[model samples]
Target: MKHKEYRRVVTGHNAEGTAIIESDQMASQMLERPNRPGVRLTNFWLTDQTPAEYDGPTETCTGDFILHPPQHGSVFRCVEFMPEDPEVMARLSSEDGANAFAEMGAGANIVQGGRHPWMHRTDSVDYGIVMNGEIWMLMDNEEDDVLLKAGDVVVQRGTNHAWANRGTEPCTIMFVLIDGVTQAGGGKGIPPR
Candidate 1:
């Protein structure tokens, strides 16, 4: 899928401590993996620690685009989800899902026998907003699903879930993920600090 281009404006302080526009341009880091066809992720920014430092690197989205955020930080990005092909979906197996997660640097997070092959867990509190089109959010429950349209918002705690774009057009969602601690001490991605 062709990911949507978003104009990102970053603000910072100049030499004299005056506010300035650090960067104002279209985000160019669109990640589209063959393992997860019809899905594209565009990372905007990443913070490695709380009370984020303002005098850090201009571009913090370096390195691999893993599914999880930094150990004690946050990640902001947008995802484009195209309608799934039933034929392709039916042919996929549990190992295929694990392999896909592995491609994203999170093989252990994949749910082997979940409701959907793309079902996976993340150790972050995600704030997701449906920016365009519509999609369905599937949880651990097989029968329970939520349909989200433009302007809808979902606060997803560290949980096992998957997204499905049942609509004909592609769905665009912006997500802000903050590292969190789970009841079982910590998750595989983000450890308790």
Candidate 2:
């Protein structure tokens, strides 16, 4: 899959900014390598990762994600996001018990590590896939972290946890941030924040 040639559709929209784009044919035949110039979100850079006291805990889960948008000419997108830079995130990632963080607003890589904190909501739902590589999810009083690779889907409900990229190269993952907070178990039946 060269330049937008694969098949994956991932976009973002919110109060801060609004952007919608896919590896559609329009993008496939007209996209730059390493840097999708004309396309938006060519870069997902985060500015911080700080911990807070509004979060219950994160669960340990792993998986892969191969994206394919609506257009046939669209390209494929893949990448895993393992809390690879835990050391750095340890200082930046949220830990104040907040609901969750919105790295998308900063275009920042949640795995790169930073002072990013949680968003503090009633229920925070994140749905995505493990494009590549593997991640070690850390949880409280949990057995062992879960291992996920390519073509795997993962969901994080109620809990306090982060990620650990135990793989070689960089792992990519796409996520959809749902509003709400943990209710019964961790983030179980919790309502949106």
Candidate 3:
């Protein structure tokens, strides 16, 4: 899939307390995993704390683009998912999935024996907005996949899930992942299914 570069315009207050454009440029922090071919992540911005403070013109996502958000923060990114390839899916292994997640600093998020190799869980509340094309949101149950289209919004709480694009074009979804604690009380882990 050919990824599209999005323009990011950031605004901030100047020394005199007037609003101004901090930075306006194309977002170039695109991450593509070799193991997960055709999947691309374009990170726009990130905040490292809740009630996010405005520290005036700072680059927050200068480091590696990890899957989970910062400890007490949130991440804003757009993920592009290409149409699924049966051969590629068949070739995927648990070790491959583990390696991919490990590279994203979420080794423990991978679901070992789930329905799909890409099925994983995160300890965050994610707001996913389908921007283009369509995708199927697969959960733990095999019979309950939800089909999402452009303009659709899904509030994905911490759950074991994966995305599958079955259409001809690539599916683009903007995601805002915020650090969350499960109601079950564990702090960091998948909630009970």
List candidate 1 segments past 4 Å from native. 185-193
On TM-score, the stronger of 1 and 2 is 1
Worst-scoring 10-residue span by lDDT in model 3: 184-193
Worst 10 residues of 1 by lDDT: 184-193
Residue 59 of model 1: what lDDT?
Answer: 80
Query: By TM-score, how accurate is candidate 2?
Result: 0.40
Query: What does the lDDT come to for candidate 3?
Result: 0.87
Candidate 3's TM-score? 0.93
Tell me which of candidates 1 and 2 scores higher on lDDT.
1
Candidate 2 residue-wise lDDT, 95-176, digit = tens: 3212122322222212232223322221344565876656665644246457767678877663444555656655556554
Ranking by TM-score: 3, 1, 2
Estimated TM-score for each candidate: 0.91, 0.40, 0.93
In angstroms, give how far residue 188 of model 3 lies from its true place.
13
The stretch of ten residues in a row with the least summed lDDT in candidate 2 is: 59-68
Report lDDT per candidate: 0.86, 0.36, 0.87
